[model samples]
Target: MTFADLALGEPVLKALREIGYETPSAIQAATIPPLLAGRDVVGLAQTGTGKTAAFALPIIDRLDLSQKAPQALVLAPTRELALQVCEAFEKYAGHLKNVHVLPVYGGQGYGVQLSALRRGVHIVVGTPGRIIDHLEKGTLDLSELKYLVLDEADEMLKMGFAEDVETILAETPETKQVALFSATMPAAIRRMSKQYLHDPEEITVKGKTQTSANVPQRYLVVQWQQKMDALTRILEVENFDGMIVFGRTRSITEEIAEKLRARGYSAAAINGDVAQPQREKTVNQLKSGKLDILVATDVAARGLDVERISHVVNYDIPTDSESYVHRIGRTGRAGRSGDAISFVTPRERGLVKMIERATRQEMTQMSLPSVDEVNETRLSRFDDRITAALGDSERIDRFRDIVAHYVRNNDVPEVDVAAALAIVAQGDTPLLLEPDAEPEAPRERRERTDRDRGDRPDRGDRPERRAPREGLATYRIAVGKRHRVEPRQIVGALANEGGLRRDDFGAIQIMPAFSLVELPANLSRETLDRLSDTRISGQLIELRPDAGRPQRRTDGERKPYRDDRGPNRPSFRDGGDRKPRYKRGDG
Candidate 1:
């Protein structure tokens, strides 16, 4: 049905028409009516399902323009999403006058947010941490808040903002209408909704498979270390008008964009770190054809509707099926056909199956583009360049005369002269990839036997010792046994944040107040900086290069490495006197 059928206000309808939004999406069609009736709503929908507009339209229609002490407050998980929601509110309220919307997140200056709040903003979109800061400082008055929205509640909790979110919710008036939107309703999110929302109308938008039916999805099984090579090969072979590469983190997006630029591709990145204005400009560049590729994290790429996006490349597989749908939905817009390719590591093969089950469509397995295929694509493009240049007679005549003179003066054959000129045009880099440098074929998938499916024996508290890997250096991180940090937690955080493969890590040793682990010796300054700021179990890692070997503990200082097994469990020393639970003859 049209937005008008949803009974949106005339001004809102005008704005929607101006933006070319004719019909309501499924989430909008289901949730907008209940929201307009001033009831609490629990919306279950993925990221790109027009959720912002679903809530934004109703809020704008019900806004009392005269009252301006933050009638509506939207809490998002990240700065990029906050800005995006704020922009959506502004866009929907364009026809209405004297309505100000402000976005407050950590990175931007508080002075700007304060000024906007002081000048009387009707809507405030912010991350939970900053919102809590404003509320504690008494800078934001939410007593008159008529609407409170917890957007992406699952993501907010995942980012460790649950306490901050509850604090903000408590500050609002109990009678304020609340709407909670999430892609997935985990137990935590469900418990939150029950505690906060009052008899909320639950709406679930399902079957995004239909939305992406026109798009073809494919998967490539590649090692983590070879993702870059696989991506380069795809770019060389795929004919795309505009492409988006999805990375898991902000740093990965920036890294991908930088490498693409260095390879002579017109690319840019948008992430939480990028300011809203710059992100807008980058998106505009992509729309205008000045940029051919956009590398982005999921939050940064929310609500992106670019008609020319012909391909979406998932450089890293998303952790969930919903995210997989949202990432690919960026393309295949406006009834245009699109392609989506995901680089799945061997460990992530199960995720592909999950995605297929969720989408009700099986993804075709794709091999890395062969060297012969790349060379053929390169030659075809080169021929096209020559054909285009032939139309420019003046420049071609000048170059032809120079080549002829060189051939005559050097007594070289005309073909040899042409080959030399071609080489010069191609630069020092090889025009084609070496056949021997091709990536290894994907490993054959094997079914898990009963033995493989069975649980393995536990390895105990501390990991086994091993020799240090070549080109790896021991580094110390500041949270350890005292902080209740575990070895797996450290490995997961470091490996994921640093974009390092599992093989890149050598060994890990947990000490009392610190731990030492081996990582790549030649980590870039940016990667190191990112690792330093990473958090494990709500504590900073503070990663630094270790010096000297760890000293052995004396007899009195030797305590169990971990004390989490409860006081009743026997300690290492106490266990020596206890009888074996299983005697040798018992089995």
Candidate 2:
């Protein structure tokens, strides 16, 4: 049935029409009427099944725009999903004036959320953890919340967010209309519905949640650290019209997108923090062929229906099979054949089996493209490029004359001259992947033994002050122990802001007042400035090149040791009573 049959407001219908959403999915058609009638709904539908629109449309239709204090709240499992739901709300509410939808989640600074809350919001979509944080801080008031939605309810429970979810449900008004959507109805989820939902109208979309058969599923067993390298090789070899690389976290999406762009690929990232207008623009660019690769978190890519997307890459595998189904569904749309590739870490092998069991489809284990394969692909592409350039006979004739002149003056063979010109056209980059530059094999990771029990691991109290890796330089930032900042916070802030990967960092020493981190030595001024402005734990990072100051001991006291011998060896101090000499095995 059409949205009009459900009696939705004109603004929502208009927005839907503009979005080209004419027909409602089964779950939407069933859930919308109950929700509009103010009846609680328990929607059982898989991901990518128009679940967001089912709840979002009615919520927008029922929203009292004059009363701006969060009329509706949606809690999603991840920050990515939270932002995705928030974006959907904004899209559906476009015709409804002054309908502000804000998404709150972890890893984002609170200042933006606090300001938005103070200014008043019509709807708030957020993760359980961040929503709880705001509630505790009294920054978010849900007393006026008329509708409470738990999207991906099963996912929230699987992520161990059930406690936080219950706490949030407790805080909301008892009279609020609740819509609980889940892909699966596990026992725990069923109990939750019984506890939280008031005689919820049960609606289930029957059928096993499976991806399109048109999409050939394949997986690569790769190490967590080598995913980017594997992805680069895949991009080079795969013949794709458009691709979406799904990252598990928002920072990771940005990191992957940045790396792809640096490697000369047309790519961009979209996540919860990206403004709705920018997100829409990015999606439009992907549709219009202006962007080739979209690195996105699951939620950011939710409900993204682009017929041009011929491939989907799971740079980081989803925690659950449902998300995997949703991610791959981005491709194989409109009856087009698509390819789905997932990078599974060795530790996450079980997840693959789980997905196979859930979808009843075996994902072919695919090996990463070897160096030889990548080189072959590159040579093939280079040949095709030359052929395409030959089509431009006018330009080729002008360049050929210049090449002929060079060959005639230098007394070189015409073939040798053509080869030289080819080299010049190829530029400074190597024409092929080096034999030694292959990515680390995932099998090696699986075969690794645990460290010796006798060996002492590095502790925060005694951080090792080792030199940075080759081609890396030490940099210092002003937030540290005093600010209660962890190494991850520093990495997350820098990586998300600067578009660098986790491997880009070397040693990260969190000092009491400041922290020293190792980064690529050749950072551009613009990147450094952007990193410098990044905030960690509410404090500006103030990132800058380390001044090579004499290393300080963690403790207040220090012993005089020979600089050449290193800190492990004892040395004589000038003021000491006697010069103490130490020998091997000396007590």
Candidate 3:
């Protein structure tokens, strides 16, 4: 239905009309009314589904412009998302007098955010870490907060920001209307909703989640650390007129694009932080063939339809299957054949399968091109280029004479002179990387092998090889037998929500009052802190360092993981730039 029919305020309606937003998406249509009435909301939606405007519109309507101590707060996983949400708020609040929306994120100098907060802002959108910083420093106050939104909640959880998010949520007034939106609802996020949302309305939108049949889909299995090298190898040989590399975060997209440009590829970045004029210019450059590659985040690339785009590369696999389809759909439009390639780590094989099912097609597995193969392809292309140059030699008499003069004056062989010219033509990049010049693959991740322990031999019944646990720190969790939690449930929860590969997790010991799980000793203190908030079977986890060895069973029953756990699983964590620094309230 039309946004005008949703009973939005006159100013909001005026802004929407100016922006040309006629109708609302299903999620927005279902969510706005309840939110307007001050009810909590739990919304499930993927990127490009208009979820931003859904929460933005209603929140803007409820914002008390008169009291501007952050009347509404939105927490996003990344800076890109925070800025994107802030932009949506600004666009809709444009017609309203005295309404101020401010975006607070990391890397941006603190002076601007501090100044904006001091003057007062109606709506505040910020990344969890930066918001927590502000809150800790007493620079941000939510006492008057009328609305709280957790956009991309699942992403925050995956990034190990559960504790930071929860801490911010706890500071907001309990009476504040809360709205949570995510592409997927993990158990941790569900538990969070139950704790904070008061009789919240639930909305799930499953829209057209399919890729174009005209696109030839394929995926390359690469180690997480090796994706850059893999991408490099593919680009050296792959034939495409124009391409777009999709990264999960704005920083990463910009970094990748910048690196490509440094290496002489015609590339540019489009992210939420980019000004509208700059973003438009980038799109136009891509359309006009001035830029052959566009590295972009999903949100920034919305409404970017360019027929010149011949290939779509998922440098970072999408968190949701619908996003994958939407990403690849940018290509293969209007009866054109476009190639869609994804770099899938072993840990993310499950997501790959999920995407395949959503698209109703099997993606051909592609091996990463070897450095030698890339060199061979380069040589072949070089030969073809020389042939084509000679074919057009009729009009280049001057260049030929110049080359002849260089050969004679230097007393060099004609082949050597041609080689020198070829080197000049090839620019600063090497014609080929050595076979050994390939970047080292990241240390192989250990996969979790204990998802299904039911089919395994009893610990006392078998003598199997134990998996390696070189640098793991034993952690004691306060949930076990009394909680009715299965080993697989714990494994799945940690693997999916914790963003850890199955192999990254070591032996799991289930006892009566607590359980012991092995995690990397190198895990950051922030990650360890978040572990305390982890829940299994609806029971809170009180995690603490365990210095002692794992308890051995008296019955000679080994833990099922050491005995039955098989090979390591794949690790594909959909794996970010410095903004100008802001002053740290140290919050």
Deviating ranges (above 4 Å) for candidate 3: 1-43, 75-119, 125-144, 150-204, 208-216, 220-233, 237-311, 314-339, 343-354, 364-424, 427-543, 551-587
Reference-based TM-score, model 1: 0.72
Best by TM-score: 1
Kindly give the stretch of ten consecutive residues in candidate 3 with the minimal lDDT sum. Answer: 569-578
TM-scores, all candidates, are 0.72, 0.63, 0.54
Candidate 1, residue 563: the lDDT equals 34
In candidate 1, what are the lDDT values of residues 1-587, reduced to their tens digit? 89999988899999999988888888999999999998999999877888899889999999998996889999887666787898889889889998899988754557998888888989999877667668878999999999999998877766556666787888899999999999889998999999999999999987654437778999999988898888888999999999999998777898899998898899999876676689889999998999999999876788898888999999988877767788899998756799999999887888888888878888999988899999999999999998998999999889889988887799999998778778989998898888898877657577788798566554343333433456777677888778776555565456445645444665566666877677878888977886787666567779977654422254535443443432122122221232322211111
**C-alpha root-mean-square deviation, each candidate:** 9.2, 11.6, 11.2
- Spell out the clash pairs found in candidate 2: none
Select the stronger candidate by TM-score from 1 and 2.
1
Candidate 3 local lDDT, 1-587, one digit each (tens): 68878989998999988876778878889999998887899999776567888898998787766786888889887665676577677888898787888888755667998999999998898877677768878999889988899988887765556777888888988789899999888999899999999998899987546676788888887887777778877888898988999987667888898888776689999875677579878888998999899998876776456889999999988867767877987898646789999988877878888887876788998877877888899899989988888788675687889878987798889888878888899887788887688665444457547665577766456433343357665677888778765555555445433434434566666667876677776776666665565665556677766544323456755433342222232111110011211111100
The global C-alpha lDDT for each of the candidates, from Candidate 1 onward, is 0.80, 0.80, 0.75
CA shift of 131, model 3, Å: 8.3
For residues 133-200, could you state the per-residue lDDT of candidate 2 as single tens digits?
Answer: 78888989999989999998876765446667888999999999999999889998899899988999
